[model samples]
Target: MNARRGPAWTNSITSTVRRVLAPLAGSGRGIFGTAALLLLLIASGYIGWAKWGDIIVRRPQYVLTADCIEITPQPPWIHSDIKSAVMRDGSLAELSVLDPDLTKRVVQAFELNPWVAEALSAVKRAGKTAPRVTVQLRYREPVIMVRTRDPRWKGDCFWPVDTEGVFLPPEEFSSTQTKAFLRVEAGNSLPAGAVGTSYGDAGVTGAALVAAALKPVWSSMGLEWIIVRQELPNDVGQPMEPTYILLPAGAPVDAVAARRSGRLVSLADPPADEPSLEVRWGHAPGREAPGEASAAEKVARLHQYVAANGRLDQLPPTTVVDLRPGAAGTAVATGRPAQTR
Candidate 1:
């Protein structure tokens, strides 16, 4: 070993050259490395194509944007509806696949109704490449329905409740508009939507009882704005402050009264704290109370007493003929005109 130290640097260079050229000299392993890399690249491409191949089929789907939200009472033409508003726009046609935007346009129009409380629109697609779309609409119910005298409605009556029976939104009308609709029918003159529902009329009911039932409704309409409507319009509100109409003694006497009030108070009334219908009624003009009596009996007696003694014309500001007991609805008595019932 001590004798070999003289040529150490030259030997080290010779050893490095042999090691560096060893693979090129005769090893076949380099070809195996190239093959491994080629296989890796091929595997990656196959896996990627397998996972994402269906993306092209899903790309062309339809969508709907409406009212920026969902709505109710969807129109008949629209596919989405809350309750009865939902309907099928297709009628044995593959139209959605041919044209998606057309379906969206029709539904949009239905959503535009002022009565609609809310509206939602979206596109629905079917099939792989060419998708078909469908639409939907919702609507608002405006009138209150009551018993009808018609044969078709059977025995059920409708109450004029909104689609949800909640009050309508204030934005639907002007500040000056105050309208209340109450309907009872035995005929087919008005549409079901206008009156709140489609129902048959009740035939041959008593007159006074019907009047009593409708009395509350009529009173409510007149007092809606806390304004006095002398009379309802001939078709709506028209006359002075709200008035209590005298019935013509018919089956729907209360209805007639209601109609008159609606016409008289066509516009919102002036502010008033006390409700007009709640005003007190007094006993007829004269005849002192002989003794204690029940409310019903007292009313009957007062009618007799006024017929015999009191001259109603003699009373002041006695617009109504109060036949109610304890003079509950009697007008003021004046010393003049001779009180005759």
Candidate 2:
């Protein structure tokens, strides 16, 4: 076949090697194309190293500051949690929030509030000397855990609570009562460290109203505590009286946060930094076992029933009175079977 083209000497391995290496830096890279490629490679390496430099070298003198969760006494629950300030965003305690080099660190320091979702924190100069770090709080819906169950629950006695559920101590509820949180009837039955909170359903109904905007609704309703009588439509709530607002159980967390925010906005002139309220609905507004009222319909009925009989205050604080059947003109507090869902 034409003498095999003399074994193709033009495409020899030596020639190809020279062609490839020819474009790269040879002995003298002080010139054009090769030098440009070398420079570009160096720049790429430098940029990558700079961006990821923090991973290896850490400095202690600088720190991220003002990244803390706000807690108050009224909720008792809140005060208990915020005993010590912990950094969210993963920043150290003493660092400045505005250090140009620590911008990334500042973004990582905030210990987000359970209700705050889209948190943004920044550092600004305050009157010249000290650095003032300002943080805008974004509240997210609280989530609870289920540690136990009660016969009263439809399935599992879900303790619908806020996000900080696990971090709370049982004693915190001893003073303020955590009943409005998700019901974990079998506290012992719960797996190790498993908590029951209001993360799931509309968070014990009224417990979701932690912000100041909704103070007006609570104020208008004169509701010292709000208890959600979580009920299925066809069964428990339908037969209740017309005066009660029968809200469905398990409202969306986002919706609850929005509603709470809206409610805080409604308060005539709420302070910029108002404390969290001890708000919930089901339990009696007392210290002792005065009987807990789970359902709004049942509570209204119980209220009417007790009004007819004048024994409302005498009911045990933990008892949830189910007055749906014949409570119209009766004052008797009937105990229902305990079924922990």
Candidate 3:
């Protein structure tokens, strides 16, 4: 080495370089071995988790049992069992709390029930021995009753509907229950549909809105029937639509008599001399024709009359009240009491 050295600085630089690389000399195999081991360890871990991940997550604490699912308090009108209805088909069987779609699945399950108008939220309470799911819901409330002439049911029968004209479970209404709500007489054109389904009739939907609006004063006003004119008036045209008339009670309505007698009494037209009053409610709320006052204005006009003359029944018989705008006070006339078929 001494004889081959060209310069002292070059020798010194070579020595320094050799010392720096001394520990790494012959360690290539070791580095390669360590890398291979690390890769093997990583692959094994992945494989192990892949094989047993489901089992680990399926533990008692991670499972969402039927009993653990909770629903928010429901209104008195909701007669159906929400939980039973939602899970009747076992749609959420074996669902896990850690499921990526847990909230979505729970919401979908609740939406299937006719009573649930909307699923507000679905929250999970995890980290417990039994994880829990809490669901917030909005339910449909029966606002009006629809008297249907369906051939399937004998005698007088009525179907309850929500404000949106969505059919409710008719069986939920008892005779006493039926009397508590306003009723609409949609003629033979009333088509049948499943629960939670709309009647698809503009008249029925309109009637529902009117009924809801009248519910506060229904009893005080002595109102009975919401007669949906099957035959649209010949005068019905632009700025004018089919009419909905509010008739005061005590006009010898057969439906009323049938319920009283508990018998199937045939519907017949009332006597020509029967004492009655007719309130011409133009159209559905927010659906007023051109030149017609808003629904609120019409309602205010109606309330004004009732306040002045007491209930509709207290008014003179055959009195006609037009709540439309620009109409004067109630007009007295003579006509047959409209029949509610």
Best by TM-score: 3
Which of 1 and 2 is ahead in lDDT?
Answer: 2
Residue 81 lDDT, candidate 1, scale 0-100: 38
Q: How big is the positional error of residue 131 in model 3, measured in Å on the Cα after superposition?
A: 2.5
Q: What TM-score does each of the candidates earn?
A: 0.26, 0.34, 0.72
Minimum summed lDDT over a 10-residue window in model 2 is located at 240-249
Tens digit of per-residue lDDT, candidate 1, span 1-341: 56755344445544654565565446667876566545645664465446653442234332222322233334432232332222223221222233435556545544443344444564555545444444344455444333324566565433333423332333333322223333323222222343223222111111112223333333322212111123224546453222222211122323333333333331133312321221112111222133323334433443553455443322332223323234334332222234342
Query: In order, what lDDT does every prediction score?
Result: 0.34, 0.35, 0.69
lDDT, model 3, position 74? 79
Instruction: Order the candidates by TM-score, highest first.
Output: 3, 2, 1
